[model samples]
Target chain A: MPTRARRWHISWLLLAAATIPLLAVVSLFVGVSEVSLAALLSGQDGGRAAEVLMISRLPRTLALILAGSGMAVCGTIMQMLARNRFVEPSTAGTVESASLGILAVMLLAPGLPMFGKMLVAALFALAGTSLFLAILRRIPLRSVLLVPLVGIMLGGVISAITTFFAYRTDMLQSISAWTTGDFSGVLRGRYELLWIAAGLTLLAYFAAARFTVAGMGEAFATNVGLNYRRIVALGLLIVSMVTAAVVVTVGMVPFIGLIVPNVVSLALGDNLSKSLPWVAILGAGFVLVCDIAGRLILYPYEVPIGTVIGIVGSAFFLFLILRPNARVA
Target chain B: MIELKSVSKQYGDTLVVDGVDLTLPKGGVTSIIGPNGAGKSTLLSMMSRLLPMSTGWIGIDGLDVTKTRGDVLARRLSILRQDNHMTARLTVRDLVAFGRYPYTKDRPTGEDKVHVDRALGFLDLQPLADRFLDELSGGQRQRAFVAMVLCQDTDYALFDEPLNNLDMRHAAGMMRLLRRAADHFNKTIVLVLHDINFASCYSDHIVAMKAGKVAFQGAPDAVMQASVLTEIFNTDMAIHEIAGRKIAVFY
Candidate 1:
């Protein structure tokens, strides 16, 4: 390794840290309701400014941070376990499975609480991930590019099933809206499930080295005395739960997981322990900036964070596909 | 001693390794040589517990490999496979340091660092230790991986085709290093080698296999006969004595 790349740099981290609050502050001020600290302090705008900031702006900002960081971290774990960089919750049918779970709960119980629905979604997500992995292991992959294509196809199959079910149940509008991933509907008490995702992201950091070892492949990891199967199961569980929480709360952001980790790896290399904090920070920052852009693009109105992220993230994904010597596992 | 009792590997109906029973004594170099599809690598993998056996038991130092705890077995034995492709961009030193993982589990002690450095030095990888594995040539990467298994510092170290992709000078140098590893440290080294000449030169005992069965095994002097070499490989070989070592010329 180059001497510069060997040690983790404090300056880069400081810059990432500096960017989050800057973006968060910017996001806080650009909402549809023109609310400000000055207005709140003066007890003006009939006190509506404080409620809007507290209920809408603050919660939306926090949701963006949680969902962004959560999805990025989930992506990292999924990629490691799947042993393919392009595999993420959305691509691998995890998001679609969670949506299917939500749809099932809506039709079956019709009385399940939000937490109950999230639990069902998580279980379904886990199963979906396992199915994708089983399919992945069956085929001999000649190119790194084929792995994600398989995942996208798997996701497409599950998505078609979910869409068909939604249409039959007359819940297509509701399900379609949920899958689009907008922070516009985020308000007090609605985004709390995302806190579970935040907690899971911390657990991922604690197990970062194990996940890194698992990425080397089952045989190599077992030789090192790690239980390859157990670690993989843990990783999949983490990815599924995080996906379920984020999907349920803020909906699906297409490629935060894919783009953030690749960018971090290119800059810092792929040592998960060293690169994890950066992944988290950059994930949060990327979403915050994108969310800010969405809020401002039509000013006084808003573009869904998912729509903006989808547009920008796909562009970045295209660049990754077209880049020279694109070595992805 | 590593003991295998009726160990076999079956993929569906094909028996890759069938009823292999052998006890490899402790210390010195033992080479398993055979033609293609001879199950040499498969048997090595089974012994190292990298591949599960279908119908038998393997005991390393009296501890059943299938029953022993992973970390405990790790401390007792280690293995290096032919293909070490990985997605993580690890430096040679970082890769070697993983040998200490069984002991340190990600937290490297001063002693672990010492072992890592010593292994790196042993393989002449000190200069390339800081380089990323992908940046190095095949021979260099092979040496780096050897350094890692050496760093594991286990009593029993297994390598599958350790000399693949190496040129002549590096191949001989690698065999010499492995020979020293066995002789100087009294470590039990098991290797699967395709090059019979290298095995003949360095191995104290050679086991030849064909069609998933051990065809012949003995001290190099006994097993390297022209008739035995010709029978196992199905090619006529002329054995010549050079510097008191048997060299087979089959090409």
Candidate 2:
């Protein structure tokens, strides 16, 4: 046999490539009603089982892939922008700001279009990120470890403002549905908007290296002729916009960004130009696997993908923090 | 040519860099040497736009360094500071590849690869190109970072304490590299150096800074005199000519 055809970083690629399909297949088949390969291939909407598969499984699978991959890449981009591996759209306040924007639109103009809500959310998210970044520049902390803590606090303040308004309006339950971001609710037309996250992922891939270079401090990047601020602005725009789109379409799924990118960087190293494609793949795969497990782990009444991922993802992040070599970047 | 007009920087009540006007000729190496707390680094930082000036202006090659698009100014100028800690984990090779980002927009072509290779080789980092930065020795990483800056291939390169952590052999090697870069490439090299001997021996022009101002600006022969050295450093110093080079000893 040919010596196991090995390429540098190929094993991760192969593992990721192989897992994508298996998880995708399992995602389609392992939902509330167990639709086997035969049943899916038969193409008949027979009984309540077929409706469950058609309405639930198919859209859930697409949503899992989209939300998972979208959050992951968004996290990756935010981490690069803030130069801290711990930060993502969720932690950096983009998601919360977006949610607030959506809520405000929902309350202020109860019949606003989804795209309009997302646009408003995207603008607020971008503004929030810029606000946090601006405040961050004020504090002279050379250690980037402290920066994320500040962002989290900044996000907390914004979230408190959001929660206060959410309570006053008594739309908590309505907003909470969009907040938890489970794929179980995603179906045909409802979830199609998440494709925007997919498009934003492509934009991120195109700008990956520029973002990474900008990560290496302003002077160094500017010295190389990169418009450090402009590249950073574009990067932040992509991150906030993608984040807003994800939150608007699906809801808040935390740490997919933070965990996936860091893991890819650790395994793949920091050539983001090379790491981005893999980040996207692994991001989508990790989320899909988690969502599928969430569906199958409890059977009939599926556990929320975000909850399952939050529990597991936080553990990975904790491990990252405790890891001796972990520098938070 | 580089020019600074009435440049000043203040942090609260303390002025780090006082109002200063100066002109620097193009080409060759120029060293900015000053006593501790004299704002040599701050002055250099202001010149390169690394630290924005509080009041005044800087122009490089006829374009305002402050007003020009960062990438446009970047193609013409570059600066490397003392500390080069990075959040991104990168191999020596990957780190050098980033130097082309301003021009190539992160999509490095074959020509970019050649430039990366040349920078690595120039810094004697060919063997360690594949090695991770964290895996390398401190001095080695310092050299790797320097190689990344040099790989930028800009005409004007500014370095703040390039020899900070280098061993004797590497320190000599770095000075030689900077000189070769200036001479061979027709590049303008600006550096903030602590070692007066290195500046005296290797620099074409010298800017001795004191109390946030340019105390003196002249050729090494003029600036390295016993009186100038004593006045600049505020210590008694003796100057000796060895092999037609000025070497100052202060005890």
Residue A160, candidate 1: Cα error in Å is 0.7
Q: Worst ten-residue run, lDDT, model 1 chain A?
A: A1-10
Off by over 4 Å in 1: A1-8, A327-329
- Give the per-residue lDDT digits (tens) of candidate 2, residues B21-60: 8888999999999899899888888877788889999999
TM-score per candidate: 0.97, 0.93
Reference-based TM-score, model 1:
0.97
Q: In each prediction, how many residue pairs overlap at the backbone (N, C-alpha, C within less than 3 A)?
A: 2, 2
lDDT tens digits, residue span A1-329, model 1: 33475444766788778989888888888877787879989987788988888899889999999889989988888888887778788889999999999889888987988899899999999999999999999999888889899989988999899989899989999988877888988899999999998999999998887888888788778888999999989988889899998888888888999999988877665667778888889899899988888889998788888889899988988898888768732
- Report the lDDT of model 1 for residue A268: 61
Off by more than 4 A, model 2? A1-15, A40-51, B242-244
Label model 2 with its docking quality class.
medium
Error of 2 at B25 (Å): 2.2
